[model samples]
Target chain A: MTSILEVNNLTKTYDQFSLDRLSFSLQKGCITGFIGVNGAGKTTTIKSILGLINPEAGSIRFDGMEMNRQEKQIKNRIGFVLDEGYFYGMLTVKEMKNVIAPAYSSWDEQTFSNWIGRFGLNPNQKIASLSTGMRMKFAVALALSHHADLLIMDEPTSGLDPMMRSELMAILLDFMKEEGKSVFFSTHITSDLDKVADMLILIDGGKILLNEEKDTLLDNHARIKGDSRWINERTRPLFLTLRETPYGFEGLTHQKEALRQEMPDAVFERPTIEDIMLAYVGGAEIAH
Target chain B: MLINLVIKDFMLMKKYLLFLVLFALAAPIVIASQTKDDSLLFLMPFYLIMITEIATYLQVSKFESISRGAAFICATPYTRRTFIEAKYLFVFVTFVGILFAQIVASFLLPSLKTGLNLNAVGAAFLMVSLLFGVLIPCQIKFGFDVVRWIFFGLAFLIPFSLGPILRWYQSLGIHFSFSLPVSQTGQILLMYVFAVVITFVSMYASIKIYEKKDL
Candidate 1:
């Protein structure tokens, strides 16, 4: 399958933070959840892909075009939503459509209005007065109105309420059903990704720790909740990030399928995206 | 792509432009009424210059820290090079617009009326004001306030630095007189052409600097 967004050997550095040789790809007709904790370089990686911050060493190809060489042409095919990309405070919703629509060649006014009705947003309300959820919904609406093949959203769900998040997920899920469109959404909210993302790319401390199909990342790995004896017998010593407590110990392992038959007493549970992420990136807290 | 970027700038500017245009047009009127400092009327372009730069800030590169959170323009099909060009050229075009408006208004205002008196020195200064103040630093620094503060602060020193020049003419009793070595029409046309050329040169320089800017 052809990838829609391909990042290769990317590296960028600030005085305090660095993204080191990070590489990943998102295939068309798939949604990739860019999962990471705070300060895990998810925003930085997204910025690099958008060409907001020039990567010191790397190449990013969107729909098979070199981002630097054909930047204008490449960006034309992409849409983006930042966590705080609030619209002009003075603009009304209808005014926003008038102002921002022309910037894209394929902006469908009818589609935008349809989304507004779907989200139940008023067309005449000023942006500054809208609630946080409303603003995020508006951003999503604007992103989709433009005929962009790839959509990159950075922490788009951080401030939203649960219902609104689910609403957004449902919207994005519906969007991915379209054949050529793909989404790369970065978020700390793992639950939002749980239902929608086909793939998960996890990063911590400026490096990619895991990038795989969400089901594969979940199914191949399982959480074992049992005593140290079970862990000692069944755990893959290389991959176990075990958390020990006063009563007992429970943790995660990549080789859970391999260890399951060996220790029948240990309770091996199917993991969520959050469980696997917290286990590795939270290694110090969970490391036994 | 450049077209969309320009329109985006216009969209962002449209939000703040009302207050800016009013402030630019009225500040000198307020000064004229309060102090009757006729010289203040000549300073109207300076006010226009300030408003143009501020509009560039609000419209174009508003953020000092580059984050995915605040990045909208940096994420667009507009390249960093084209981004800076639009800002610089927009300033140039705005300056010309203001200059033309001033030329027309000078004829209409009874109290503040005077024929335009642009000479080679005045023309060069306009170029310097357009480039050194508005264009170069914006391209180099890439933040609105950072570039504006540095350039305006230095420009603020120009009058003070000229104290010695003012003192020399006073002390020597040797009067200085200046004139462009051309006919009135030639001078006016030359200055207009110079403004156009300088604007483009500075615009090109801004594009070059922006293309090389490290992020």
Candidate 2:
């Protein structure tokens, strides 16, 4: 599959933190879930891709074009949905649409209006009055209306309730119905990705810990449950993570069969994306 | 794209448009009624232009503060340079709009017409342009918060200190005078040329600053 975006050796630094030579690629026409904990540099990476922030080193290429050389053209084909809608509070939805519509060369008035209506947004209502969910809906409407080939959303579903998140996922799925369109959705909600994401990328501490096909990532890892005594120096390295709770001990591993052979009484089950992610990040936090 | 951004700013300013128009008309009338010299009323347009310019500059920051609109705009296809260009255009267009209003209102209100002087307006234009020329880039580079302090000095402290400076000069018994060596038209033309040059310089600087900004 062709990559829609190729980020190579990306680096950015701040007083408090730094993104150290991070790298990843988003495949064309697929939903890539960018899963990371809070302050894992997800937003920073997205911002850098959109040229909102400059990186000290590395290159970002979109559709085989270097982003720095053709930022305007690259951006024209991208629709970005920030966590919160950014619009003038004083203007009504209709006025706001008029203001933003001209920025995109492929802006479709009918599409904009249709999405606005479908989202149940009042054209005459002020943007400031909209709730968080409504604001996100408005942002999605704008993104879809622009005829963009790529939608890069930063923590788009962070604060949303389950119902609202599902509704957003539906809109995104509908958007991807057209070929050559893809979505880079960053969120902490792994369950949402389990439903729709074809590829998974897990970032922690400004570094990519895992990047693979969603099914492959799940298939390679298993959740293992057994007595706390089963965790020993000899077997501990075999488990991706070995943690003990009051009830017993459980861990996750890619070599589930090998570990099963060693601990015949242990229970081994298929791992979810969340389980794999937690095993990697949750273990690191506790170890530190 | 730039036009769309400019329109958005205009729509944002729509709420204050009517109030500004009324103020522009009523301000000259009130000032002229107090002054014996009708020619002094020519300052009305200049006064209106200055006050409105400052007010509008102040309002520019409000657009981005709402919903983090700056970030939103940055996320769009428009470049940072384009965003800054739209702002400069917005300032220029708004100035032109006010200038047109002042001229039209002057025709309708006889007192303003009696006081109108093309050279004076032209001079006011130069000063206004120079003020914003310095301000726009600073606002773009450091953002509204840091620039607001600079704006406070420009808007209030400098003007307020002038009175004390003049008193101190009087106490020292010092005097200064200067006469224009050129005709009224020549002076007006010179001011316009200088204003245009300053505006471009400011714009270039703003674009450079904004391009490096990590918004």
Candidate 3:
């Protein structure tokens, strides 16, 4: 499959934290979930991709065009919904739309109107007056109205209730129905990714830890539960994270078959995206 | 694209601009009535233009800072140069708009006609250009909030320090005086050229600062 967005050796630095040569790409027509803990350079990476922040080193290409060389052309094809609305609170919805619509050559007034009506957004109301969900919907409306090929969302569902998140997921799923459309969604909420993301890219400490198909990632890793006595030095190295209780020990491991051959009595279960993320991020901390 | 950005700023500042324009029109009439000074009438248009320019800048800066709209603009198809160009164009258009309003008001209220000449207009343009030439880059570098406090600090400090600063200069035992050998028209032309240079330099500086800045 063709790649929609590509980043190679993307590097950015701050005094306290730095994104250390992070690299990832989103395949065309796939929803790629970018997951990382707070302070893990998710926003920094997104900003770099959007040209909001200049990276120290990297090349980001969209549809085979370099971002820096064709920034305006590249941006015209890309739409972004940041964590915060970042809109002028004083302007009414229609007025704000007026401000943005002119910037995009392909802005569709009819589509924007349709979205406003479908979202039940009041065009006359100031953006500040809208609820978080409404603001997000408005943002989505704006992003979609421009006929953009790629949607880049950074924590679009953060602070939203479960219902809004589901709605947002539905929107993304609907958006993907069109061929050659892709989404690069960044969020810590793995459950939302579980519903829609085809590919997953997990990052920690400014580096991508894992980038693979979601199902393959889930199939490769398992939650293993067995007697605490089985967690000796030999077995400890196999588990990504292990937690012990009085009754038993539970752990996550990608080498589930290898462990099964060693300990035939161990119980294996399907691991969720959250479990995988936690296993990678939590390390091997002892839990009593 | 630059026009769109400028229009956006104008839309954001419309309410403030309306209030300022109303006050700009009425305040001169009220002050002219109270002070009964015809000379003050000539200065009134310049003062109003300056006030309108500064108020517009402050409102736009505060809105952008509070709303993170600058960061949002970075995501758009417009380049950083376009954004900076829009700002310069916006301020220039605003200055002209207020000057036009002053001219119309002068026609309506004949008493307000105080022989507003090219020299006065040139002086007003030069003053605003110098002020914004310093203010824009400072706002971009330090942010609106810090620049505001700096403005306030200078406002308070300049008056109090002027006496002491003069005394310090006297203590240095240095005296210098010079007069330019130029015609009135030549000086006016020079002032206009200086204003244009200041504006472009300020714009170049702002663009460089903003391009390197991590939003």
For DockQ, the strongest prediction is: 3
Location of the lowest summed lDDT over 10 successive residues in candidate 2 chain B? B60-69
Between candidates 1 and 3, name the one with more favorable DockQ. Answer: 3
- Ranked by lDDT from best down, the candidates are 3, 2, 1
DockQ, computed on Cα atoms, for candidate 2 = 0.70
Worst 10 residues of 3 chain A by lDDT: A279-288
Predictions: Cα RMSD each:
4.3, 2.3, 2.7
The C-alpha stretches of model 3 lying farther than 4 A from their native spots are A286-288, B34-39, B157-186
- The residue-by-residue lDDT of candidate 2 on B128-180, one tens digit each, is 88888988887886778787777777778777899999899899987788879
Rank list by TM-score: 2, 3, 1
State residue B213's C-alpha deviation in candidate 2, in Å: 1.8
Interface RMSD, all candidates in order, equals: 4.4, 1.6, 1.0
Fnat, one value per model: 0.40, 0.84, 0.90
lDDT tens readout by residue for model 1, B44-155: 5555555565555544555323322124655665556666666655555555555555555545454434223454335534654555445465636566567656657767
Q: Please report the candidate that would top TM-score against the real structure.
A: 2
Query: Considering only N, C-alpha and C atoms within 3 Å, which residue pairs clash in candidate 2?
Result: B42-B115
Q: How accurate locally is residue A26 in candidate 3, as Cα lDDT from 0 to 100?
A: 91
> Candidate 2's residue-wise lDDT over A1-288, tens digit each?
999999999999999888999999999999999998889889999999988888999999999999989888898899988876667777888887787777788899999889888889999999889888888888888888878999999888878889999999998899999999999999887888998999999998899999999998888888889887877777788877777888888788888778888899998888888888887788655422
